[model samples]
Target chain A: MSAPDRFAPLPVTDTPQERGDAARNRALLLDAARRLIAERGAGAVSTDDIAAAAGVGKGTLFRRFGSRAGLMVVLLDENEKAHQQAFMFGPPPLGPGAPPLERLIAYGRARLAFVHDHHALLSDAGRDPQTRFTGPSALHHTHVRVLLQSAGTTGDLDAQTTALSALLDADYVEHRLAEGATLDELGDAWETVAVKLCGR
Target chain B: MSAPDRFAPLPVTDTPQERGDAARNRALLLDAARRLIAERGAGAVSTDDIAAAAGVGKGTLFRRFGSRAGLMVVLLDENEKAHQQAFMFGPPPLGPGAPPLERLIAYGRARLAFVHDHHALLSDAGRDPQTRFTGPSALHHTHVRVLLQSAGTTGDLDAQTTALSALLDADYVEHRLAEGATLDELGDAWETVAVKLCGR
Candidate 1:
């Protein structure tokens, strides 16, 4: 399937009012799920708990997302879209205004932070290799590839992006943390390599 | 435990006469295990099959390696040591006596090849986060760190190694390939990052 089809955020329409309601509903459900997940954890939080917390019917929860896993994916996709917007349009150096190398460096920090914040849901996605490799990852690869090109990298851009993206895998980050690596070290390491790739 | 203690290879004594028999037995069993795994895959090949193929008793297999998992550990350790020695003392490029940047690039290529050759066994290891993170990976990170330092990398050397090693993770490599990445692309990408880190 196409990248957007696989990972695009809840489709926005031309109309603002209907989109607002849909957006609000999504936020409500996600906020409730996030609260329950934080209180207990991903494994313990259930569909019933989230729906009840959101003051929405169980049927609406199921209709909005087919299952618990589906809900988690939608939540993660929301984060992914926000990240895309941050890098694509938000502000420098993470957005379009900065130099290529600096933008790439900022992008790494932003992506790593996103992975850290959404650790529970994203790590759950890591358990399945297909889900881990698809959708949002495609967008990430494209983003990195564009940055590499804009930065005047001479090597195979595809490979560079793949290596960079691999570092952002939540499973790898979690594994590194459990292995005693600090978040500071993780971001620092990314900057070292990313700057190098940007020919700085 | 220290990194060396956690990920170190099986030690062989300096006295050939004393170590020869033990080493021979270990090699003999491993040879049989490799053949059996190649023929029927790691999961299908039983301990009994390895023992029978090696012309040793089942009791001996159990005595040498405590369990199936232990046997797998020993097998991986053998490969890990070869990798360590290659980058530490073998010859130019992959070994000592080459430019730091060359050695680092060679090391990345060698590590990728090792992961590919031992794909099944290592992929199995990826299922357990502790085993996956603490064992051979510690050695890999150390190896990469030393290379980065020797090549004059100034940023977060620790994080740089972590990111580089994550790209070589068997599960991640497999996922990338399943998502349509070629080994050539993967290696080329490593060279890009390694060379850049080396300030080439």
Candidate 2:
């Protein structure tokens, strides 16, 4: 008996308009959440409140986002993607155009800046342990791993990648923020550590 | 008038018997907890049940250990202090007599071993964020920081300490454990990283 192929392509649907509508609604929900968080706080904003604020029904809100944490996750996802894109493709040492080691240093700096700038959103979204541990996109890890490899780090690239991931772990970053460390200092320190980890 | 002295002698008392009693009770409570966790797991063991298992009243149990999380913390404290002592003063590469780098590596290995052996206790005790975050004795940040300093780590010791602490953060460690990495691998990898950070 031959093994079944799992690679059969499924029929594709042209759902451009549907996708656009979903995107718009997501923006509205996120905007509503931010407004609520700004006016009150992340803890003060519930799914029901977000739905009412967004002018959508609670059921629709749940259908779209699943839960309050899920909605917060979407907010974080939007910001994280934006940051990732900026670092991966946008400009300067953080973008595709820089020397590999320079890019690695810039990535850490940019990441520290991002975390500092969006402290509240990250904290609120990461309150759920499941979300904290696994909600981050694989791209985030991949992005750093690629940079480490490109930077010519010696000895066990996988271990270096894991160590780098630990550096970017949300809770650790948040703790530094809570300790009142400045973003610039964090960025500088990260550059130092990154250089050491990546070599002379 | 002279400038008043800012410090005063601590009021001291001999409480040897009281200390001994506390230690015995602590052992009893921890044993009860271990048994309960064995039978029903950490989630199922309540403070009341713990008190009953140890043949003590809930008030006595709470007085001795403030909450269920606190009780768990005390249990972990015993284990942590033991490990701390071993690294700080016990013998060989983990003790004061070894080369700084060797001691650092040994300390990491010992720490990993401790976590592996006390996995359930740490997990259970750390259920409450407040319990995990606060308390002078609970967070081992300072201990690790001191070790890094003594190991002759170059540059900003404070920053390196925080970065090193990030490496050992419980959430990250637990996540890695769940991802199927062995304790020995973690210990070895961390030994490498610690040596790098210590500029060995």
Candidate 3:
């Protein structure tokens, strides 16, 4: 397909084969990109490399994701969704089954682990301030708000939400880790904050 | 003196007249810069404008501050020192002699108020990430670390310090203000975090 035609097929009541072909191509591209990221890390993977690996033209890569940053965002979105699921429904201490205080602590620990696991992806997403503030992972805001509500905070919801923003400040995280703080310690302190702020 | 030569006088054994002149010039430049900042926020003020206002050549301004961002840092330092003092010695809840928990709460309230009062200064200093991170006013880190220690946290001091860093994250503060959070709410939350972390 031509560069322009890639986006042209959207929402079309078209032949099933074309749609199937497009879906297969997308999967191929995504799988190849994932392999590259796993092998060499996000910074090492280039769009040309992804295209070459997937056997698609450079135009196809551009058409799929507007830029390298956009691709990173996609990869991060998948990671975020999985993390969100783990917290929302997958297991104890992090999911719905644990006590509120424990859950809060568990949440922080899990989040730190996830951040460490996907350090490059998260950091890349954060480079663009606009994206960090407004991207769909804005689920971050929602997640904390819900947790605070669960913990019995009766204060202003907006303030609670803003406080959550601070929890994600990268410099603070970097400084803490650099200062020799461990994941367990951070998790415990967050649990303390969460318990105090939300009560019981 | 030329900009380079201006700094060359820093190591003098004794140059009373030069010292006096330098002092007077510094005062004049700072006064003029403050007036300009008050009349038109920090963004509107420039090195050239400050020099014109102070009736000094541009070289003098550059020589004195090193850069426009440095000038903002100095301006911010004055207010930062005063706020630091209040928490160190001012009054009940925020200053010396209060119960540690109450004092911690007061510190947050005081900081929130400080941010409100010096919103322009904070905004200006934040423009340069380097200044924001390394500026002299980062004494908040020290202050917070001391408070956490006094409050009886028994964990690794390094971890406690990291927790303190999270408490002072700038994004957290700005997010609170942007959400129209009241000074009381910020103070209350800070107190809550302090108490929880301190085991009070």
Q: Write the per-residue lDDT of candidate 3 for residues A81-145, one digit (tens) a residue.
A: 77888888878978888876567668777887777677766666665434655664577767777
The DockQ value obtained for model 2 is 0.25
Q: What TM-score does chain B of candidate 3 reach? A: 0.75
Kindly give the number of clashing pairs for every candidate.
2, 0, 0
Lowest lDDT 10-residue stretch of candidate 2 chain A: A8-17
Q: What ranking of all candidate models by TM-score puts the best one first?
A: 2, 1, 3
Query: Which stretches of model 1 miss by more than 4 angstroms?
Result: A1-36, A43-72, A171-189, B1-75, B171-186
RMSD of each: 8.7, 6.5, 9.6
lDDT of 1 by residue, A22-139 (tens): 6676678889998898899776788899989998888777766656666787677866887788898998999888988888888888888888778778766555444555557667
Predicted complex 1: CAPRI docking category: acceptable
Relative to the real complex, the DockQ score for model 1 comes to 0.40
Q: Candidate 3: lDDT of A109?
A: 76
- Candidate 1: interface RMSD in Å? 2.4
Each prediction's DockQ? Answer: 0.40, 0.25, 0.14
lDDT (10s digit) by residue, model 2, range B1-25: 3345336443222245568767677
Q: What is the descending lDDT order?
A: 1, 2, 3
Q: Write the per-residue lDDT of candidate 2 for residues A65-184, one digit (tens) a residue.
A: 766767777777767877878987798788998988898888888877776667666666655556655565456667777888888777645456666655554556766668887777
